[model samples]
Target: MDAKSSATDAKPAAVDAKTAAAVAAAEAAGPSTGESVRIDSWIWSVRLVKTRSIGATACRGGHVRVNGERVKPAYAVRVGDEVRLRHEGRERVVVVKRLIRKRVGAPVAVQCYIDNSPPPPPRETVAAAGIRDRGTGRPTKRDRREMERLRGLGAGPGGPSGGGFAAQGRPGDRDPSGGRGRPNGR
Candidate 1:
């Protein structure tokens, strides 16, 4: 009909042709597992790390390992390889189940790897243990002494009760020379 309508019709045909070509090429290439992807790219693709650059940084920092050996960012990764990443004070171990080049959604990304990480430590035990109230502010001198006593560092049972000259009494309170403050009867 109109020129605009004809142009739109031609665009879809071109896109379809490209899609068909891509599918045919993929079929010809056979299984995806036969090809290896870069470790940094794979890590980012599977959501193991936030960004490809971060993954590369981690690799360079010696925080990434493949099959128990540290590997560089450009290292090739294949299916069935075990990857260990140390991040945020915890270690994550995963087995690669699929290889993907582009980053994917969380669900699909998770499907690409088999997580073998140990369970994270309980939050209460880590962050809440001995935690004081919000408005408590800094500890007072008495609180410090009590805490030291609890840790067996203060003068208490099971700890060294005061040490040196201070343990007895003040200099004027007790005569260290054994004159009883009379100063040799003078």
Candidate 2:
């Protein structure tokens, strides 16, 4: 009885191992040839876009190109195509290395494409914008003036005419000429 029970257990274990191996092999092989995936689906699957819908939206918005030509979302993508996507103020250029139709982990997604994108532009060092330190009392009159001056809203050496919103005047301030028409009269 013990021998028979062990044989049964061994058979199931062997089958499980075989199944796992087959799945792994499929993943390693990637999508088979003759099976095409949509451009949007491919981009989303490979982590080029946040979501499949966003990929489609980018395609419709003319932000995605394949091999230097604009393509629609449903366009078929094959291996070895150059894909250029303009997204979020930068362009991502990649060559398709593998074809996948489902979103995968970051590690796996990266293997699907060879990134040829240019180095991103260096971030400009901008001064902190009006962030007051915590627990500081309200700005004094001088501090207020200084803040306004830094923001180009203060009266400069040339007074309010120094090219900024200050010269535009408050929305409620009426024209001194008592008319709202353009100076040259349309």
Candidate 3:
């Protein structure tokens, strides 16, 4: 009964070698969405968005790009490749670290992607004409009523109900579609 030998023999030498080889292979591939990662899955794995659907939505919405051109979810992102993402009102650039096809943990997500470029300078922003920001921060009850009073969204196709689009509906509740009213505009 050799204690050291017994422990050593618990695992087959071949199994140990196989495990070591698998780990080495995974490490060689770098970070990925999972054991095997696709570009879209990898992006989802990296804490970029809350879900894979959001990542795909961003891509379909022209918010995701490879280099300078918009790419679809099927795009194969690899190490060193650049990815541009438009989130909220800002654009972010990231580099691929590894490809993982499955969802990953937060820490693992960080390893799957890299930041390659900084967002654009804010000074160059140009607010679209006719539309103006009433204010920032959460809207108070009074503020909501005031915004409704000064509704500024463009009008639906034909003329607005009583006034024009900007004049008739509330600022954030413009009825773009003919169906429904302001809040529930279809």
Candidate 4:
């Protein structure tokens, strides 16, 4: 055989060997039954949880469920299974689209599941309702009262009976004698 032809023949054999090795590796790492993967592994592999340990912890804490039933970390998860994970104060609902045992990049991870979470609340409506300006110092009595009123916790304009402090004598109105000392002879 000419030198060029011999080199070309060797290339095909090398490619075939690489392909066989890949196939063996995939089979060894894939699910034993080729139908389902462990829930914790799947969650971590798909990037639903930051780590496998966290995914397992969530499962143990009852923060993860499959098809409305709480499942253990080693529970088998098959395609089309609905997984609900409650983490970081939010619930993520996703349907398994594919089974993955190894962690993948964000793009591939996203493809393994279909997210069904609700849209987050708007920023304006969810901002801290009682946030105060920085370096403003403590709120004045007037400001505190206004905040209480806004929260419907303060007495009304009619005084304490009406839900306000007006009826109660102010510090200045109190007698120095410690008694209801009539300042002007009540």
Cα-based TM-score, every candidate: 0.55, 0.61, 0.47, 0.59
Q: Write the per-residue lDDT of candidate 3 for residues 1-186, one digit (tens) a residue.
A: 699887778768766676556545545555534333455566776767768888888888999988778988877776777888887677778887666555555545565577765756676576444354666667775665455555655333344534555445666773466446545453
Displacement of residue 153 (Cα, Å) in model 4 is: 4.1
Best by lDDT: 2
Candidate No. with top TM-score = 2
Give lDDT for model 3. Answer: 0.66
lDDT sort, best first:
2, 4, 1, 3
**After aligning candidate 1 to the native by TM-score, how far in Å is the CA of 168 from where it should be?**
13
Candidate 4: minimum summed lDDT over ten consecutive residues — where? 160-169
Q: Kindly list the per-residue Cα lDDT of model 2 for residues 1-186, writing each as its tens digit.
A: 999999999998997786666545536555666878899999998898999999999999999999999999999999899999999888999999878777776756776789999998877755775678999989987787788878877775447546445656667877765665667443
lDDT of 4 by residue, 5-124 (tens): 999999999977866665455446667665778999999988888999999999999999999999999999998999999988789999988787887666566667899998766678
Q: lDDT at 138 for candidate 2?
A: 97
Q: Model 4, 28: alpha-carbon shift in Å?
A: 8.4
lDDT of 1 by residue, 106-185 (tens): 65666678999999877777533235578999988777777775666767533366644556555677464566566555
Model 2 worst lDDT run, 10 consecutive residues:
156-165
Give the clashing residue pairs of candidate 1, or none: none
Report the C-alpha displacement of residue 27, candidate 4, in angstroms.
9.5
Local distance difference test values of all predictions, in order: 0.78, 0.83, 0.66, 0.82
Residue 97 Cα positional deviation in candidate 2, in Å, after optimal superposition: 0.6
